[model samples]
Target: MGIVDSKGHLYLKEDPEVWIKNNPASRLALVTSFRLNLENGVEEIAESIGELTHLIHLVFRWCRSLKRVPNAITRLHKLEHLLFHSCSRLEELPANIGNLVSLTHLQLSHCEDIKFLPNSIVNLSKLTSLTLCHCVSLVELPANIGQLASLTHLKLSSCRNIKSLLMSVANLPNLTSLSLSSLSLSEIPYNLGDLKKSLTRLDLSYCNNIEFLPNNIANLSNLTSLSLICCNSLIELPSNLGQLKSLSYLELYYCNKIKSLPDSIKDLCSLDTLIINCCDSLTHLPINLNVLHLKLLNFCPRFLPNGLINLKYLRVNICSCSDESFVNWKDPYSLQHLAISSCFSHCNYILKVPASLNQFVNLQVLSLHYKKRFVELPANLVGLAHLCLLDIQHSSISCLPWSITKLRRLRHLMLPKDFRLETLSYELNISVIISVNERHVRKTWEELKTEIGQLPIPFGGEITNDAAQNPSIMSHPGYLWLKENPSQWIINNRNLLKLVRFLDLEYVELTDSIMQFSELTHLCLDIAADICLPDNYFVTFTRLTHLSLHFFSVGKHKSITHSLSKLSNLQTLHLHMHHSVLLANFNMPVSLKYLSLSYCNNMRPLYDSLEKLTNLKTLDLYSCV
Candidate 1:
């Protein structure tokens, strides 16, 4: 069962005679539970897996050409799980591997030339999770390694030249989680807290000259996650660092002479995520970091801890504090999410706007990236009517006011990235440009030549029906949706009067205003060559439910999914064509849950008709050849 194509990509081939005629000890008994992986391709199953020893997991991991492992697997004593992860040309191991004493789980991670191990593997004795991570030419072990006392999770991370990690393997008292990261070793063997009642999680990051840390590490206290990152000459913390009271994550990054911390660090009040990046001699923080109930607070500013007062997700990334020190609103009001980089990058020499920023009234999203020159906003930024999402990426913004089209509960207004608009208007404020120049500025120099210079640049960005029939904008609603989506005349004319429910003409090549939508529910037309679908093209789309047509070419519906199955509550469907244009020969409609087909390269293998849809959860077949 293999090679599935049409862009989804699947391979799976090999079949040594259907696994040697369905596992033959020469007999027949079949019911699922079968397993045999000769690790990698080719090797044609070592002369038929030595005749399938009642296989229940026999993986000759990466069996690279001939070389042993076939002492016929010591006659499989009902093998359980012997995975040789990374058989780096596996050098040795078939010393009858203790005859698979019903092996529980033994994975030789990295299996590099198998340096040594096999004191008959302590006769497995029903092994419980033993993985030699990176086995790295494995230096030494098996001093009865405490005889694996039913070990529980012992991962020796990057065990290179281990040096001497054998303190009799910590006497394995049912070990629970132990990792001596990059064991370059410099000393930690102080009876590592005697595995304090089964340690929880501890990683000695970059063990470099350890420098001291194990007075029984305050007796583990069921340690709840601790990493002394880059232990660079580690210098502090051990006045019983608050005795681990179930320490909720503590990562001391790049310990550069470790300045200070540990006024008993407020006894770990369930600390969330705290990444101390670039410790740069980390200056003081933690006067209990504003009552430390943090949910992800990444650090950089040489350690920020000034009255964080429980900062509610604020990323002031490296401060220089100058939008008058962020409007000086001190209360932080559990700030929802604010990103203030290097203090408003000279935001147009801000003269005002910090009317205490309405005390961040649970602000939703505000992004301002201004390097300087001019960006002073918020003159009653409409008192932030619960601002939805305004991203002013790098600013010098020329204009945007008409009370920003009266917020009307604004959803998303993201302009600023090359947002060079010469115009977008509703008589643009300044008191509507001084009341249209005190009434037409004395009979017009082209009537105050504004109105987006008489708008019109293809696809619904219209505005010039003699400037929307300007007898003072005869009830201008984009000049009645530009005479209701009709085209080709003056520069533009959008006369749809208010009611713009949802319209997104993606790659606007213009022309084909779908009868200019009468309260369009959702329409996104892309790469337009020519389009116009609303000659009642399927019952006036009674509140259409998302339709996106890409790479178009109209007037030839070889039967577009049987005419889009007549929209019957269409959820979301996007079709893209070109390359091998065929308006028909298709199958869709299970009331699409979300479908995407792009660049019809040659459209064949539709995954067996897209697995009968079944209210699909999402399917994207891009560049479909």
Candidate 2:
């Protein structure tokens, strides 16, 4: 019986014995926003909820048999947002709760039986966002919490019996985001540089007994994000930390007794993202870091900061390096995304693919992970040419270089998901091909139309249908043919197709050359048999937006779920069905925002079409039964 609307909002999830039997002056005093969730047998909350009195947003979520919180809610004097998140058997919080006075946002996170806080909550005074994250029996705080005075965001992460902090929190002065992550602090408040002019985000991540750091913390200077993730007794880091200068993100993960980095950090210069993962005794890296996104995991830095040159995203993991460690790795040349993993699992390492990687002539994403002695790949990798995404995972690279079809802006080719191709370099004119050996596993649609009429045709002569209806030869910008007779070169180069991935082939009938590309935007198909795709077969691509379908059975497909709800610029949808499939009129695409379903079965008639997606933001379910 709670649903008020018309400006005076009010929402309450049933069961507090039916809204405490209503009648709070009938219209609940025009509640100005009040939300209450009663998780099962609610334990308490009805002081007639202070008769609403135009409550300015008050939420008590997941009551979990709530236990106390009714000091008549501090008499809601125009309360400005007070939340008891999770309410895990809430234990405290109403010692006058600062007498409301228009309190400005306060959330008791997880409230694990909160232990301390009501020191009159420092008289709120327009409190500006205070969240006690995971208050695990929170102990100590409120040593006059710096008299609140418009406190600006403070979240005591994980609380963990908070060990030290209250030096009156450097007298707040509008603290700008401070989270003592997973505290049990072993040192920090030496007046914390008195919140150097309103700190701008500082999270001592998982403070594993913080080792060193108070060199006035480089006097903040408007700190812009600094997180010492997994502190691990952080060895050192205050060597004037380049005096912050509006630092822009720095995360030293798993600290590991530091070991070096303070060469004044080459004067940060507004450093833009630097994460050194698992800092295994860091070993050098401060030669002139004009950082622009750099990540190194499991550490490895005998040398590689020849003045980065405004590096643009570089990631290296599980280092073992030694081809002269990238021969002094010099001049990043504005690297555009590069990732390397398992650098070379030692043991007489023989990986070799770094001929200085052609000096990144504007590389655009190249990732090679778990290189189990990576076998091969450098046929000058087609001289970069703005390479557009090439990923080789769990590699032992088995044949792929027919000069990789001379790249020419290759659009996404990710191989090695246990890839098993024994051959296919017959001057490969690639489109999307995956052959799972075992003598062509299962290809019988007339041997897949006689192997698509013996493939191989990109840029290899042939013109006349009046030069393919010349509009300057169909908007020339050649070089994207993807093979001979590939459905007549994909219907005369349908606007130079954009991204198509087909894996585990077999019985693949290209669907009229995939509806004539028409500016296709990423499509992946993995069908291994039981076809069924004709409900207007994707209704003319329509600028398709990322779709992946992998089905082995689903035989009598129900019009492909009504043509995936008439994709209106579909945004990422992946469906994998094998055998048991009854999407029961699935119907997705409310302009989907990433939806993944695997091995779906009954799924209770797809639960009201997944509640009409409502612009779904990631909903992944596997082995759905």
Q: Give the TM-score of candidate 1.
A: 0.30
Tell me the lDDT of model 1 at 598: 65
Every candidate's lDDT: 0.54, 0.69
Determine the C-alpha RMSD for candidate 2 after optimal superposition of all C-alphas.
Answer: 18.3
| C-alpha TM-score for every candidate | 0.30, 0.32
lDDT of 1 at 9: 25
Q: What lDDT tens digits, residue by residue, belong to model 1 across residues 290-364?
A: 343332122333344545555555544333333454443354565555654433333335422334555666666
What's the CA error at residue 540 for candidate 2, in Å? 24
Best by TM-score: 2
